[model samples]
Target: MSAATARATIQAYYDAFNAGNAAGMLDRVTEDIEHRVNEGAIRHGRALFAEFCSHMGVSYREELRDMVIFVSEDGTRGAAEFVVHGEYLQTDPGLPEARGQRYVLPAGAFFDLKGDRISRVTTFYNLNDWIAQVST
Candidate 1:
């Protein structure tokens, strides 16, 4: 994969997310993709990823804005930074009670690419910031 292709793949993944198309996002990842959730455990395989997406879909409605993507010259690695504008739709376990609380968070993700698909995704965000925003 070229750098351009890596960037495009990352962009398409985000586009699918914004479109609420989980299948589209899934298409960009490998069958054994490793998903490192923000402040959570690492999940392996497409099936686990699908489950995570389903839970997130029920808990929050979110859009990533001002995204900037970067890819390595070798095209084996990539990263993206964005702002998440979201509304908490349901109460997630161990989180604050959700009453449609709105929050804006700065987040980023690092990716490991294999061929044309993403093999790993490790996401990062300020959990305290998110908690404070939803708590109020």
Candidate 2:
């Protein structure tokens, strides 16, 4: 894949995310995709990814804003920086109680690409910032 194609793939993934289309997002990833959640465990495969998406669908509603994507010249790596504008819809285990609390947090994801699909996705954000925002 060319850098341009990788960038477009990342853009399309985020587009699917903002659209709340889990299947669309999955379609951009490899069958054995690796998902590294911020401050959480690394999950493998598309099925696990789908499970995570399902849980998140119930716990939060989010839109990625101001996204900017960068891809390596080799097109094997990519990253995106964005702000998450989100509402906490339900309480997630080991997290704060949710009564529709809303938050805006800066986040980013690093991707490892294979061909045209994402082989790995590792995401990051300020957990403390998120806690403070939703705690109040």
Candidate 3:
């Protein structure tokens, strides 16, 4: 894939997320996608990814804004930085209790592309900052 194509693929993934189309986002990934969550365990495959999306949907509502995407010359690696504007809709286990709290946080994700689909996704953010913001 060309660099432009890779950037488009990554951008489409975020667009899908912002549109609340989990399945559409998943469609852009490989079957054995490796997902490294922010301050959380690494998970593999599409099934687990789907479950994660479901859990997140129930616990929080989020959208990415101010996105900036980057792609390597080889088109095999990419990254994005964005701000997450979110609402804590319900309590997640082992986390602060939720009461529809709103928070904004800067976040980023690194991507490894195989052909056109994303094969690896590593996301990062300040978990403590999120806790502080929502805990108030």
Candidate 4:
């Protein structure tokens, strides 16, 4: 696939997430997905991804906007830029306060894709900003 195509596909995955549909996001990825947030938090397989989604239920209710895609030269990889808007699910990990305050966080990700499946994903976002959003 072209870099642009890969980027578009990745963006669509987030679109599905924004809709609060974990199954939808899974549809865009390979059965064996690699999701990594830096080094310590690396998740593999679709099942794990789904479990992770469960945790997100408290914090994310399909709120994402301003999706932008950035592609590599060869199309083997790409990145996305967007903003997440939601109520602060303070109890959730990597997020903010539980009292449900309005929050916004800038997010980005790098993807290693094969065919239509995303084989690997390295996500980036500001934890501090997330805290600000969740904290009342």
Q: Please count the clashing residue pairs in each candidate, in the order shown.
A: 0, 0, 0, 4
Off by over 4 Å in 4: 38-40, 93-97
TM-score of each: 0.99, 0.98, 0.98, 0.85
Residue clash pairs of candidate 4? 18-62, 90-97, 90-98, 97-134
Which ten residues in a row are the worst by lDDT in model 1?
16-25
Q: Model 4 Cα displacement at 90 (Å)? A: 5.9
Worst 10 residues of 4 by lDDT: 88-97
Which RMSD values do the candidates have, in order? 0.5, 0.6, 0.6, 2.3
Summarize candidate 4's per-residue lDDT along 1-136 as a digit string, tens digits: 8877787778778878877877888888887889888434789998888888777775555477898888887778888888877775546644343775776788878898888778888888887676655665
Off by over 4 Å in 3: none
lDDT, candidate 1, 49-111, per-residue tens: 999999988999999999999999989999999999999999999999999999999999999
